[model samples]
Target: MPKVIFHKHGQVFEDEVKPETNLVVRAGIKQFPYPNLRYECGMGKCSKCACKVLAGAEHLPPPNWKEKKQLGERIDQGFRLACQIWLTHDIELCQEEITA
Candidate 1:
């Protein structure tokens, strides 16, 4: 069980994320910010799921080809495809820092 903290609207939401959880899906379920805007394409086509990795990158799976292609060189930065992430440790998300 890993904790996922979401900082949004001047409020902090902390929850434990189960294995194989999709960030976008979880955000949508938790209604973080504008869930609709956060999760547009279930597939990797849409960049809606993209977000800045505040922490836990070491605990997250490496970006797949799709994510790499979508993120381009930004992948080298903190940007990551939230929908493709499978939590291995605690992670934090912030709407203000979202890249896509």
Candidate 2:
């Protein structure tokens, strides 16, 4: 299992998930990080699931084309699409609150 630390709206959410877990999929199923992990389009087309990796970034693979297309230069800043990440190691990340 991998421990996930998710920060959003000044709150911290922590959970242990199975290896290779996708945050968006977990959220969609109303698991940990749900209601905090803002996401749409689990296919990685939407940037709504974007989050900044605060720790354990080295464990993640290089960003894929969708992340490169969606996040652009922000990738250099450690931002990644949760939908596109399959967690196999502990990770800490933050998602800024989106205002309507």
Candidate 3:
């Protein structure tokens, strides 16, 4: 199992998740972090489930074609469509980030 560290709404949650677990599905669970994540399409088209990777980004598999198109240039900045990604290893994710 891989550990997923989630940061959202000033809350931090760490859980051991099975390999290849769909993040969108996990987000839908009340016990998971970011319980309010929206998914209109349940596919990559909505792009509403995007999250920011703040650490251990290398642990995730490369973005697929759908993520590539939806994320566009944000992909290069560690943004990923959670609906299109699966947790493979330890990762620190934030639902929102404030940059100055």
Candidate 4:
């Protein structure tokens, strides 16, 4: 298991998650301390789960086709679909910090 630190509202929601756990599942398991989390297809087609990867982007699994497509031209901006982010190590993530 890897610890995930989700930063929101200037606070951190830390939780231990399985390596294969995706952000949406983790969020749901821990309940939403984070935001902008919605699911329609649950297969990463919809971008409702879009999140900004403020840090630890390298600690997650590589982007899948669905995420790549949904993120489109924002991949370089650290935009990633939460449903597609598979945790690989302890990671710190934040949405608001993306623009900072």
Best TM-score among the predictions, by candidate number: 2
Tens-digit per-residue lDDT, 7-81, candidate 1: 666677777867667777765666533443356775788766777777777877788988998989978987787
Give the worst 10-residue stretch by lDDT in candidate 2.
6-15
- Using alpha carbons, what is the TM-score of model 2? 0.96
lDDT of 3 by residue, 1-100 (tens): 8888877778787888788887788767754644645455658996877788998788788999999998899899898888887777777877774355
Compose the digit string of candidate 4's lDDT tens values, residues 1-100: 8787776666767777777777787456655433444444557877766767777888777788988888888787887887776777877766553342
Model 3 global lDDT (CA atoms, 0 to 1)? 0.78
RMSD in Å for candidate 2, one decimal? Answer: 1.1
For lDDT, candidate 2 versus 3, the one ahead is 2
**What's model 4's lDDT at 53?**
77
Task: Arrange candidates, best lDDT first.
Answer: 2, 3, 1, 4
Q: Which segments of candidate 3 are over 4 A away from where they belong?
A: 29-31, 34-36, 97-100
The TM-score of predicted model 1 comes to 0.76
User: How many backbone clashes can be found in candidate 2?
Assistant: 0
lDDT, candidates in the order shown: 0.71, 0.94, 0.78, 0.70
Residues forming the 10-long window of minimal summed lDDT in candidate 3 = 30-39
* CA lDDT, candidate 3, residue 72: 97
**Whole-model lDDT for model 2 versus the true structure?**
0.94
